[model samples]
Target: MENSLNTLHTIAFTHRNLPVSEIGNLHIDPNDQKERLTAFQSAMNLEELMFLSTCNRVEFLFVTEDIVDHRFLHEFFNALYPKLSETQRKLFADSAEDYTGIHAVEHLFSVASSVESMVVGEREIITQVRNAFEDCRKMQLTGDTIRLVMRHTIETAKKVYTETNIARRPVSVVSLAYHKLRDLNVPLDSRILIIGAGVTNTNMSRFLRKHGFEQFHVFNRTFEKAEKLANDLNGTAHKLSDLNTFDQGFDVIITCTGAEKHIITKEIYQQLLQGETDRKIVIDIAIPQDLSPEIIAENNVTHISVEVLQEISNANLKERSKEIQHVEQIIKEALYEFDHNHKSRMVELAMRSVPEKVKEIRSNAVENVFHNELASMDSESREVVEKIMGYMEKKYMSMPMLMAKEILLKKR
Candidate 1:
């Protein structure tokens, strides 16, 4: 059975301890995707494979019968991010796990539920997992197990969202910013500055607008991208160099940039303070952190980092206790179905081996009967003996075949 179904290994590497500077450098280069795929194809006998590359993490999930050596996985990682040193490699590689059957199903469901996300219940992760599944489909790399697992995970996530209030309020960094802004008693008419024109920033801008924030200023390292986002949102755009021009115009600053280091330092916040008409709120959503904690500790300023928001988000999640219970029920149901299917597949593969064994036994029995006939029987008697032996072989095997069928039926 072990030889038939294959062992499963799931490997994930993320920017857990890596500096923000290194994360920006590790951004997925579209041109390199094909090369990375090629390297994976060469390294393992993959029965199923999915590669998920996002701003927060890059993970590879694979299933295979062949025993995968660490060297192959190491090579694949090095190829994807050559900048990683031995220390970085160790940090990233520490999260690998091997799961078979039921454990794998549970793990996948947990991931879809955002239980494994850096920010729990972040809805963006569900979309990310869906996109990763689509990519796997595009590569023609998925099989029955991968497809079933993904389908179950997606369904479980939907159930979690619909059944739980985990997603009821704003839990994403952008939404959390809106919540924090409101909590800080910042008026809806207060001008807000959103730094970075990437997806996260764009989403944050939309969220702010949805909450009736009319005054917005967007800045990016690339002026054109920022301008495009600003135009769409009917806000103003500025380059990083022009950030000082706005001074105290912004009452709330929300930053989600790919900058390697702190874009908002003590000096910049001090300048804002110098021109302040009132207190200001700052939310840093970037992974490595867009705002330094030291700057946040200053007086007359309110700052919220991603880690702080995560705690708030978790507290909010706990408030939805009934919904979480419902989500747990959904996950259990989904896991049961997934595990049944996985075990059924293994049983089917095992049953396939039965036919060859039966045929070998039949051939050996026929050979012995023929040899005995040649030594002691006439042509007519030989024919009769052969017929009898064939009947007995079939009759004897039929019981085992029926038992296998009954086992499958009971599983169903």
Candidate 2:
């Protein structure tokens, strides 16, 4: 039987210092898809492989029988990011081998369960993982081990949500934005400006409206999308070209655009600062950052990056510590069941070989019976003998099949 206990290798890289809020600034070119696929093909002898690229992080997940060496990972990363310099190469080394065996399994579970997420229990990550799995399926790169593990991970996450309060409080980017605003003593009615019309932006807009932020403005590269979101939220839609125009009017500015470079540069900050009094809170949720860190350091400007939001997320994690113990227990139990069931399937495959052996024996017995009856038996007698042989063969194989079924049922 093939070994079902395949090792999982996962590598994740996110913004260095930004909080979870600023993760939206991270960017990857669509052209990198081929490079990533090729890299995965080269990196490991994987039974299954998946790559998840998001604004904040790039992660690769692999299921393989044997451990992979760093050379493959090195070449893979190099191929994926041909633009990476020597310094960046060192910074993004594959850390998978370091967490082999149990640690690796736990790490994967943690990620799938959202324990390692920037925002703990954020539901979007599970969807992202599923999408990655689907991509692997499209590439014909997945097998039973990967499929089972991913399915288990997803199921465990759902169980955690149902069995805990993790999702009840809503610890997503939108919720975190609202929390930050409240923490800064910003009034609920404060004029807020949200840039971008993507998932994160839409969520932020919805949260703002729910929390009674009456005055709002939205801007996106796509005017139609921005207008649609604004209309849904009953806010004004500003053209991306007019972004600089309202810089000073908003008390809270949240930008989560897909722009590769800084959208709100020093010039824009300077303009916002001229009329702004006190601290104007700006949250750059984009990976490359919509606002420059240098400008953020200026007086009267309070800038929060994705890394900072990660810290805030960490604090929020404390609130759910009670639930962690429960979720961990559930995950462990599920993992054990999954492993056991996988082993049982292997055993069933092994037992299936018994049926072929039984058939071979039955064929020999039937031949011997024919040899003895050839002189005395008629055609009807020969037909009856064949029927009896078939019945006897089924009876002989039944015990082995039943035993295999029993083992499978026991594991389940």
Candidate 1 residue pairs in backbone clash? none
Each candidate's lDDT (Cα)?
0.69, 0.70
Q: What TM-scores do the predictions have? A: 0.66, 0.75
Best by TM-score: 2
> Model 2, 1-412: lDDT tens per residue?
3334546666666533433333332235434555567555666456666766555566667776665566765775565566667655554563232444445556667776777676777887777778878877777777766676777778888888888876667687667767877788888788778888877778877877887778888888779998999998888998887866655476778898867678888877666556666778887777677887777666577787666776677787787665778878887888777666666666666677778898888766657845776547899987887788788878877776677667667745
Off by over 4 Å in 2: 1-4, 13-35, 42-45, 53-57, 94-105, 119-124, 135-141, 165-170, 185-191, 221-228, 236-251, 258-260, 267-279, 298-300, 347-379, 382-412
Worst 10 residues of 2 by lDDT: 18-27
Output the TM-score of candidate 2: 0.75
Candidate 2: C-alpha RMSD after superposition: 5.0
